[model samples]
Target: MSGQDTSEVGHGHGHGHGHGHSRSRTVAGLLSRVGHAIRPHSHDTADKTDQALEASSKGMRVLAVSFAALMATALVQSVIVAVSGSIALLGDTLHNFADALTALPLAIAFSLGRRAATRRFTYGYGRAEDLAGIVIVLLIAASAALAGYEAVVRLMHPQDVEALGWVAAAGVIGFLGNEAVARYRIKVGREIGSAALVADGLHARTDGFTSLAVLLGAGGAALGFPIADPIVGLAITAAICFVLRDAAREIYHRLMDAVDPRLVEQAESILSGVPGVKGVGSVRLRWIGHALRAEVDIQVSDRLSLVEAHAVAVAAEHRLIHDLPRLTAATVHADPDGSDGIDHHAVLATHR
Candidate 1:
């Protein structure tokens, strides 16, 4: 027994069966993280980026269909703007066209995200989706700037907008097109757990509201108050800036590896239920594209053999995957249950 190897486990500071910590995370983040923990990939097959790639296919299909609809709407609005010389219609046309173009970078991102992992980029190209989010934020900001500028200019030099009825109709058309696209993108984005797609959908929703502002302007101009057009455009600009701020925040959280606190709770619950686990340690989760990857530490009895400890860890991992269908990969660490447990800090430093 003295010569036989035994595996000991110990927990780090804070997390234990009795420890309480503030959790900051969303339900979406929680579910995604839980999913990754439930469907863990073994360390030997960690390079299986195919799972990530296949998940992005749904987003691509959504982008394709939405792009076509927006393009047609923009084209129609641009022709009307050119013929009518309505400053208000011009703002709406530019916004519709700009919003439509956003799908370009997003499309590229989804394609890149589906690529297999490489040695230089071991995590694969999933972060490209976050980069696309930045692109979206910028596009939204640009639209806001353009709208504000046009509104100020129109306010200073009020112009008699021609074809008031047609301008009014165009505004309604923009609203309908944007609303439909928004609903579709948001629905699919949620289904696929794509933050980028969801953000883009929010952007479209704001655009739809701005389109209605164009309607207000058209209506006011018809009633002989020409300044109403630019006023609505200014209002639309403010709304766009609001959307930009929110979308950027969500992407920032992703880049920072922020996951919902519920995921931690979910992980701990499963680890605690494992037959050999004595105490659950730290559990962390993050979204890489739409998939979640989980890393957790568990404490086992000091008396357990090295093989037994490893088996316990394996068992915990299997249970996680069995419980959550969305979880794709997990890394579980087993520690000896006591203060005299293996000095992981020292061992980690040695490995580093």
Candidate 2:
């Protein structure tokens, strides 16, 4: 199957064998069971597909709270910048405001992502998150450019930065605010498996460091070295630019459907472990927004009937969804054992 089909695979076969299975109920075992049930777990061949936006909902909550915090931070810093006339503080404040605004697009994307799939768009609106990711990368780039421009201008045209103490205090405020937001965003992003949100959290962390740079600028100005202020501002700009490279790379990978090799390996391992699966073949995994979707190829006995082969496929798929975190769906394609790696025509002819 061409892997573009993001739809989950399902089967309705009822096997008629039942028996009591023995298992240990150790503390670890009980905890494992509890964890498995608690997480947004998917058992392969799920009767109903998981709501793809469940994580997006969580993402929305995080973004909302962060947006408010950043807004307040920017407001306070803006007041300080106006009173102190510190160019460095001004740049940092502007960046904070810009960063705060980015949450809006991501929130919109998450909301759009919750909508049901349409006939024209078979994959639903999950790609909106990736699109929002692009917007976020661009915003980071723009913030860096603006900050850099301001720093270079100030360097060429030196200005007396007044109220060093207030500037320094505002810098601390920025750092505290950004660090708080960073911790929150990173925690929620990891829980929801969102690379975009994680990248944003990293951006916030960079902002916190830049805020510290503002304190350095203020100290330098107070030490009879006005040039240190612009230099520190430039340093802040450089930091933002450096992190922008990472954010852009992350977004590029997502747009290209690049996934971690470890996830692919894990899926293959689980598929091979499933009963009746003779061998694991190709395993492809990708992120549709924060959720993972997999396409697995398994080799099973050719001697089995079509119904039995399908059962094996369903079982393998169920195990994959259950074992893999953030796995929303899996499409398991069952091929006859030993048919893999052989000429396609040979297998086709035998079947014919």
Best candidate (score: TM-score): 2
lDDT string for model 1 (1-352, tens) is 0000011111122111211223443334334534543443344233234444555777888888888988898899888888777777777777777788888888888888766667677666767877877887788778778878988998998888888888888989999999999999999888777777888898888888878888888888889998888888788778877887998899899889897888778878988997778888888887777766677888877755555565567667667755643455666788777667467568579667
What TM-scores do the predictions have?
A: 0.82, 0.85
Off by over 4 Å in 1: 1-51, 339-352
Please provide the root mean square deviation of candidate 2 (C-alpha atoms, Å). 7.3
Span of ten consecutive residues with least summed lDDT in model 2: 11-20
| lDDT by residue (tens digit), candidate 2, 24-44 | 433343345335423322432
Q: What's the lDDT for residue 1 in model 1?
A: 5
Q: Report every candidate's CA lDDT.
A: 0.72, 0.77
Which candidate number would show the highest lDDT if scored against the true structure?
2
Q: Candidate 2 has which clashing residue pairs, if any?
A: 44-318
